[model samples]
Target: MPSPTRPSSPPSSPSSPALPPELLLLVVDAVLPPNPLQLLPASHPATKTLLSLTRVSRATYARATRLLRERCAFVDSARRLADVLLCVPRLVPGLPAVLSLRHMTALYLSPFGPSLAADDLPTATRVRELLCEVCETLRRLVVQMPFGSLDPLDDGHLGVRRTLREGFEQLHRLEEFVCLGSYPALSVPPEGNTDVWRLWPELRRLVLFGVPMDSHWLWWDIATLPRLEHVVLARPVGLDAVNIKDEYFHKLPRDDARLGRDIKVVLMDLVYDLGVVRTERWREIDPEERMTVEVFEVPLPFYGDETPLQLVTEWARRGALDGSVWRLGGTRVRGEEAG
Candidate 1:
């Protein structure tokens, strides 16, 4: 009987044939991230390199496709993204834009400034529907859409806001949701939108960079979300107690939540190094005043890079955040242990 095959090329051999599918996969894993589903963007050099390898050979193509899984999908272009997701899966859903991500799990989208959402509402609507269809299997989502005052949330001329709400209603399997830019989606759907929790039954982390929602909307049905764990706010620091009502903080449902259950609490920055989670406290304001909320990154995608908020939720449980948790009320501080 032949002995089991090994991974490395023999030392004496100056050259060797192509690596075995398993060995090639190992090499690919070493080059790319260990967990592609976390936060890698499609255009990332690592992702692009892996994508290139998919064309090496038929065997490598099969291996790469399994590895690809569209894990680190980045929607620099919504139309392009929709086109790919619509076709990548073996079985695509039947829809106007075609929905379904049979294998993909994570997604990251750059901000859809007014030019995209406002100039062409029809295209925007299709993209939104496609995303919802993909949500059937999507576990984690990172969206960087900062519409703020300009968002037509209140005005229904474009109907973009309503369309998103209805689509998000189908994101039942979504476990983690991250919103980039400076605030939650434009239309937060009044206080009652009962289906909010239904859409995200498994949600464990909800990080909002620049989530400046009013308290009424801030506390919306948070108590009903049974699985919500971390709710980090990146920008708009110093909201202190005055800006956020105490009732909102006390009402959060998951007391045994993973980390920073308090609404808009400035907790810690999670540093992902060597698989260990290290926390960084808030930066000082003007070298003297400490900011209550720590800004993660500039709201826009072009400003800087985006990290996985799940890193914060996963590692936040290990450190001591005593007298460090900064609530919206500008002054109150607590050393809440990660539950």
Candidate 2:
């Protein structure tokens, strides 16, 4: 009889090599996407996975802290920021930099009260100072202005801009920009707000929610922006639209080499003829219509439903179907403002 064979030992698992801090951070970026935790609710498995990364190592913890700090949507904006950040420093070991918000990158601003109130001025100023400090790294930004009140001198608009001009001009790196609540009647005065939108050569995408796309020079700015590739008018309800002239479409096969790709403009509702009312029906759209108009629904109005970052992400993916599948961009903060 053959001797009983000894039980075979199970194969041992290989240990992962220790990655350098930079590589480790890159790994975290690839997996977690800045602050993926906010995309999911607290009890969600994905949120748990992202939150778990905070404890993985000293390097990851620091990155996580910065990600959290980048977009702090306080039910109360003032004390909440300091209270949240001050407590975190003790938890993240070895990285002293995480304690200071000097490395912070993004901010979300929403005006409070019926109109910009006098008492709120100090808070607005404080927020603006914070924006100035982070101007170097800040890329994606969200500002909520009062509806139908974007007139340059409106006290409410003035109240929010207490810090806007000072810090906004400094954001040379500002890329994806979003302004919510400003309807078609509301507009960034071209004369007063030239620096607000025009200065950023790096700006590729601009989203204006609840905006009226008038033929005014402000709407026409889309054509002049050298690097702008996409413009989205969420909840747009205008008889007409502004777009790259129809002449460009006819020239596509020949001019595509020069045109490369036409800047895509989207609307939430039908494209009305330039002077038509929102309710007017068109038997047929004229072939000469200037914009490449597609009808897309603005994300549903619900808390935690859509974020400015998420809106940009969707537009980016649509603009380049074969290129970047933007699952999310910047640090998403479930919307503080609504259309």
Candidate 3:
């Protein structure tokens, strides 16, 4: 009854040793390395792990946020688009919150919904707002809006160039610009003094899908962008009839021919008849030419479920579409073309 020995408490459990700050940072880097080529989807295991680490501590979040920003996903749908926009209000009053729009490096804009054109009123406003938010950081942008949608966004007065300039000109750091879907030449009336291409001083790669093959002015815009190196003219199958004139590439003007360090004309679906002139042109290019044009025919069937962003990221990751490199003028062209 010595006061029941005061019911002595059990010995406290020992805690694990804290890792050094530098060591912790090293571990984080190992877990989430910088990937310039591809942006993993949010559902990916590595992406999920990085997101979980953001909540561990302030120190971890400080480092993880920067790494997270570099590997953001391709924004494609209205639902996914909303997810990024939802977090915009937490950090800054009007600015999009980090871990989503503000941190995004790649963006793919297509028809937001079955009934909604990308430029339909409120949708256009949202896209413009989102672009404004991410302009400072966005590096890759892929646009796949419906035909004539750009003109309607600005009351059908200014044309596609004006619409594009308003939404995209601010992205000074944009490295890759891809425009997909059928459309008239964006440079209809000429660029005048304010060349839109010059706005993206850091642009390195330009991919045009379904843009008319004869859009010489659009092709010449590449010269204005000092840093542009690679240009891809991808003609997917099932589009409107291909009205390419004979020797279209061979007769390209000297200045327009050298658009970039290397130019690639890619024809998906492997239409042998359609690719003949392009192949001939590719073979005709002088091996000593300062700028080279390489033609490719890939057997990419219709990707009903896939978005253009996925297609482009696949191309970027492998340096060729779907790992099947079919140089149109080379020995392997027919074998791949037959498929």
Model 2: lDDT equals 0.49
- Write the residue-wise lDDT of candidate 1 on 1-339 in tens digits: 999888886579567676777887777777666543445556667778777876675555555555555555667565665566556554413312222345467766653653334454554565566666576677766665544544554435666656555666677888776654445454554643443433577886665544433455555544446666445554433344333323244454334352143323343332322121122222211122211233232122344344544344223211111112212223234222211
What is the alpha-carbon lDDT of model 3 when measured against the actual structure?
A: 0.53
Q: By TM-score, is 1 or 2 better?
A: 1
How much does candidate 3 score in TM-score? Answer: 0.67
Clashes of each: 9, 2, 1
lDDT for each residue of candidate 3 in 194-221, tens digit (9 for 90 to 100): 5444568898876655544454445445
lDDT of 3 at 170: 71
Using TM-score as the measure, the top candidate is 3
By TM-score: ranked, best first: 3, 1, 2
Pick the winner on TM-score between candidates 1 and 3. 3
Q: Which of the numbered candidates is closest to the native, going by highest lDDT?
A: 3
Clashing pairs in 1: 183-210, 239-328, 240-328, 240-329, 240-330, 241-328, 241-329, 241-330, 322-335
**Residue 115, candidate 2: C-alpha displacement in angstroms:** 4.7
